[model samples]
Target: MNIRFLAQSEYFNGLHLKDDIVLEKEYEQGPFTNLPKVRYFLYYLEENIRKEVMPYTDKVDIFNITDCQSESDYLYFIEYVDMLDRTYTFNIIRYNITDHTHTKIISLKDNLKLYPDNKQIKIFILDDSNLIIQRALPKVSENGKLKEFFDFSLILFNFVKNKQIIIEDENLTRNGIEFILPYSDNNCIMKTGYSLFQNNRHANLTKEEAAVESLFVVNISQFISDLQLEQPNLVMNAIDQSYYDTTVINAKLIENFLIYSKFNYENNDENIIFYDIETKEIYTCINKTTTGEYLLKNATVIEDTPYMIMKNSTGTQFFNLISNEIDATYPVEYNVRFVNNNTVISTIVEKNIFGKETEVVCIHKFPIKKVILQEKGEYIGCVTSDKETSYIFLK
Candidate 1:
């Protein structure tokens, strides 16, 4: 039993059509006698009432009557002023009934009709349990044109929980979009499984090629020399040229050499000591020996006074001193004694030997006792004083 008003107006000549309109239960039998006469009376009453009431500009007055006998038989009347103060009559009917389900169906049909050709539709499917699946690219026509049909296929693979798949295509020439495929049916699909960039610019060298290139281009001797100059405390040595040339022909040999070199260089240098068995003095010497008498100038000798000869446990001849305790002359008779394990040798200068001036001479040697051997079964071994620490291996 509700009534709604809608705007519906028309113009004729220079006059409005609905300037005066009235509604009654029976237009032919009412006291007004006819619809036109009732309309004219409504126009006159509306003018007189408006002049008395003077309603507000923004508000409209609506009157309700509860004494009606039938809700469906109610009537409405409208009256307004014209430019020439003339009157006219018009008729209108109102109804209230709506079907929401029918409206929804019509809307769906209209939306589907908008894309009849299916130009850019895409579809995706997933497998139930297997890791194998097929992917179909967009179908192309014989003339190299893409089909208007949708593009997609089923994906089958074991699902990884709590992980997401991301697809990325940077070139605008290709479709660039990302979507999440839920882990359903115990499987998941990845749009971009493999990386587009697999081949790299750097070429992998073979064993032989690597060895030769590393030896020729790396300048290992220069590297060792630089390390020696920069860090004198580090015990570093380059493999002999013959060894390098032989190993350079094979890449495996170079890798093995690098591995061995790294292990040898990792320890504390102070733990390593160099000893001259022939001279019985602690001094740094090259591994290769030279024939002929070589005098060691600025040598760190044990005693203040010179001695005639020094000997190690191996009965090798060492150095000769030139001065004694009294006049700084070299000792020729007395033999020096070591305190522990033939390591330290010290001379005793008594008052009787030097006539009042007491002096003692001592020699200290390098302490590197054991070298690590990088071979099967054995892990360490000892190296003689004449051999380099790198050449020694555990056996």
Candidate 2:
């Protein structure tokens, strides 16, 4: 097997594969302006050539390009900080790849009344017309005591029609909707955290001591549908506690199942739980580990077979979502970075005799009977992987 090296850089942030071309972004802070400066380049692996693409030279505090549902158009944001009020403001810019034109969609200047003190912003692009923005900040108590509570607000904006709906939940102390992703082509599921004043699972703790972090799944398709219809203040009524437990902390929607980790606080161990959305039943894989946490990823094998990667302290486990079984496992020393139908790529960090650390790549061919090849370099992550070719970025 041949491992191809595309490009190496010092300011490498991320890499993406779109069709036959590879997109690379190098990010750095402007020395004078203190604003973020980004350089985008495209790599043609067949000819071993690289060309600089977009050069965003504008002076902005925080500039970002986000991909939405549209293939022809993308969304970018320009943020600035107000020193007098100590607040942040931003504008969303729509860039068309076909025409290369810029259009401002949502401006915080116009909606200052609605979004006044947005400390941290997270934007979610649902489709071509729908977008969700989450504004969150820590909620300070009356006596200025540091607490775990937070203030969260959601903005459902329809840029095409130039309409928006705002919803705020002030007392979302239980982590406040930590993650959101597409559940299906038309639906979305939110992994929300909440604290019940009582130990609902185990009644061994007092009320104040029962403030443990738990997770629940909420289907927000209705909110999306209502936002598209120009409805304001749409309610979220699909939160079901039967689908989760206190043991589950983090989750991700993979195909039809909500894959998450169920951690036992007392034993300090964790396991994988697959909750079927359709059947409302959960299948637990009892491979316990002392890692106490895990990262879940959705991966595809050759011929577009679905699989999930459960990374724990021991190693990475390749779980076959179709048959509900773990097919393979890699050691903890070898951090599995990417997986595809034909090959699995991992990175290993080693220290030299001088005590300096370096990362190298290990390539395993499917069904991974043995390590077919090993390449030495700073293999940070994979840009793209397929049946034949794989692209990775180096430090």
Off by over 4 Å in 1: 1-316, 320-395
lDDT of 2: 0.55
Q: Highest lDDT: give the candidate number.
A: 2
What lDDT score goes with residue 113 in model 2? 32
Candidate 1, 113-168: lDDT as tens digits: 22324322222212211112222233333344324221333222223232222222
lDDT (0 to 1) per candidate: 0.22, 0.55
Q: Could you tell me the lDDT of residue 250 within candidate 1? A: 14
